[model samples]
Target: MRHGKTFGLSLFLLAAGTGGALAQATVVTPLQQQYITAYVAQNPVPAATYGSEFDPTVGAVVPETVVLNQFAVRQEENRNWDGGQDAVRSMLYFVTPTQQTVLVEPGTRRVVYVMR
Candidate 1:
């Protein structure tokens, strides 16, 4: 009998095409657990971003209002959503040494106290 690679190939393709859904990678550690905790405490969502780590001895103190302002500014820059539904909470950020500022929305995931 002649060997038939064609039939095997078709069967493989059909099985692969309609066989199963792709599996997702499992996360062993908790995901954004701290941020969730902070959100409940903060109440109003703040525009939060991950920034470069700063030295604690630098004598830089981040205020609450400033964070909110950053949130507002960033939202404006990104043109975040129109209103309702996709609407996101405003937020802000101020880096003292660089004297740079950024604004963004916290979206649905708000953080209370962003800390180490």
Candidate 2:
């Protein structure tokens, strides 16, 4: 009887732990979901490092044309860069010409992450 009780308690604890972990999962926004759908359609076979969460190799060039094409008038409203000297603390999402998804810091206008 003790063994059975211990097994049941163990199962309950395992279930509760897994449920909490899943509940804390990141919620992707609607725009991000849209970008994911489009990006996946083009990139069927993902690279080894694709969608890695800890990537720190965002390039320095944040092109005006790419930003203009994806974010049109929104960029004008979100232009918080003053003389382009400060580091961007906020993240913005963009889809590249080749259908790659990226997160960028608007204040610095540099790519901070890529999800491919």
Candidate 3:
């Protein structure tokens, strides 16, 4: 009976941890997508050339060697453009060779959004 209780508690803890991560995940709306696309278009950067093995997707970790740039706009402008979401404003960005704009979380270097 004690072993059963321990297992149940362990499962509950694991679910709670996973739920927290899911809650923190970003959900880009169509309006936000348009904003991102326009922002990238207005401030062009040279596309990065990573090997074929380095395909970037949402939630993928970008390599440390790859250069990431902050959004070119001023903080106030960025806040307005990103709908005042600090999470969106704080992301680092890079252009992929295929013309996709990838937004990465600064701390994790993980791709949060890939705007095609």
**Each model's backbone clash number:** 12, 0, 0
Better of 1 and 2 by TM-score: 2
Best by the TM-score measure: 3
State the lDDT at 51 in candidate 1. Answer: 45
lDDT of 2 by residue, 55-74 (tens): 32354335554441232223
Residue pairs clashing in model 2 are: none
Model 3 Cα lDDT, one tens digit per residue, 8-65: 3433343354433442245555655676687778888889767777779765778988
Q: Which ten residues in a row have the lowest lDDT in candidate 1?
A: 20-29
Residue lDDT tens for model 1, 44-71 = 4433343455321212333344444432
Candidate ranking (lDDT, best to worst):
3, 2, 1
The CA lDDT of each predicted structure is 0.28, 0.40, 0.64
Cα shift from native, residue 94, model 3 (Å): 0.9
What is candidate 1's TM-score against the reference? 0.18
lDDT of 3 at 10: 33
Off by over 4 Å in 1: 1-68, 71-89, 102-116
Sort by TM-score, top down from the best: 3, 2, 1
Model 2: lowest-lDDT 10 consecutive positions? 81-90
